[model samples]
Target: MTAEDPTHPDLLQRWNATLLAARAGREGPDPAPYGHNLLARWAEPQRAYHTVDHLRAVLDRVDELVDQGGEGGELELVRLAAWFHDAVYRPDRSENEERSAALAEKALTEAGLTGHEVREVARLVRLTVTHDPAPGDLNGETLCDADLAILATDPDTYRGYAEAVRTEYAFVPDEAFREGRAAVLRQLLSLPRLFRTPYGAAAWEERARENLERELRELTGAS
Candidate 1:
């Protein structure tokens, strides 16, 4: 893998191309055209979470699954879902996935997909609402776990994720913010499992547990 060899198939380049082409032509919607209009609106420079980097991370994971030859037709569906999962992200909104799904639905329609295809894409996007992947949907489960891959990263990477999340909520007061955030992390750790994929489960489970335990210790000053 040389400097220009290009690794990882994160639709980031394709997405940037879409944006660029649209801008160059000045004849269509923004770079990434969603089927729905007027989704959640985040302030400029989404800053930390929900940024292109996070989207790319999720996309990379989806691509990994696809290359590993899993998910079937749901592969592209989940990949597209990853792209638009955070499309309508707003720090102030609770129904982020609902709004993001709207955008994905619109994009699928505009892409000349059938109504069923559009709906499937929308459903995939909705899976990120609470990161609960259904047992029956292997692809959906993969994407959901990928979206939360951050939680299972090594301690140093996980710590960076925690900082990014905290930065996202800079508006909240320190005490309440720490309380709320700690509770959220703890609850996530309480889940019977973190990453749903067999490979991810084997590799990241212990590290995620360690990360969670470390965070909890920091929160209460007791290990």
Candidate 2:
């Protein structure tokens, strides 16, 4: 379902609550309006892969890591990052991540988060573009892994995710899209590791590689 469907008021409420909880009792502007504004952005029609469902999935992955003791006590900042990671999504724009990071910084600062915490949130959001973090950057690793969790989903779900991404880029011709998508898959395959965290690597690496290669072959008509 699209973000504008209005069937998930609870998710929107949770988004608002998450933001407020990020800076609990600190003095700042009310974050509910900002939360709703972000929800509207996610609901925009140009998005397919990057939507409210994507955000929820990232948050769920964070919870999964937390359950597995992998989050390293940075859950709050990670949640804020997830909320803003795609807040500025533009299917045709290359600077979406940078803009999203800026948005995170502004919103968090307005919400009374300390400058350090705001920087952390923005850093995590920006890392979504590369999905790479220093070896000891647990918060970055956690957010990046969660953002990419869809790559490891079951086949049918993976196919759906692929289609949604294509839909987001529907303006591109099929030939161009195929070339672009194949390039992306090849880059992903070239990575030393798709997932940075041990938990993510163990849980998703093989499946994500299979999914990526399969899609790459299909896109390039390779055997």
* Reference-based lDDT, each prediction: 0.68, 0.87
Clashes per model (N, Cα, C within 3 A): 6, 0
Error of 1 at 211 (Å): 1.2
Model 2 clashing-pair count? 0
* Model 2 lDDT per residue over 1-223, tens place: 4536654676667777777777777777876788788878887889988988888899899889878769485778888898899999888889999999999888788778998899999988888888878888999989988888899999999999999999999999999999999888888888899898888999999999999999998888889
lDDT by residue (1-223, candidate 1, tens digit) is 2335333233435554533442344344443423212122321355577665677688677767556655455565666677777777667668988988987777656655557766887898887766666666787778887788787787788889988887888888888887987887777787788777776677667887888888878877784
Candidate 2 regions exceeding 4 Å error are 1-7
Residue pairs with backbone atoms closer than 3 Å in model 1 (clashes): 19-31, 34-106, 34-107, 35-106, 35-107, 36-106
Best by TM-score: 2
Q: How big is the positional error of residue 200 in model 2, measured in Å on the Cα after superposition?
A: 1.0
Models 1 onward score TM values of 0.78, 0.93
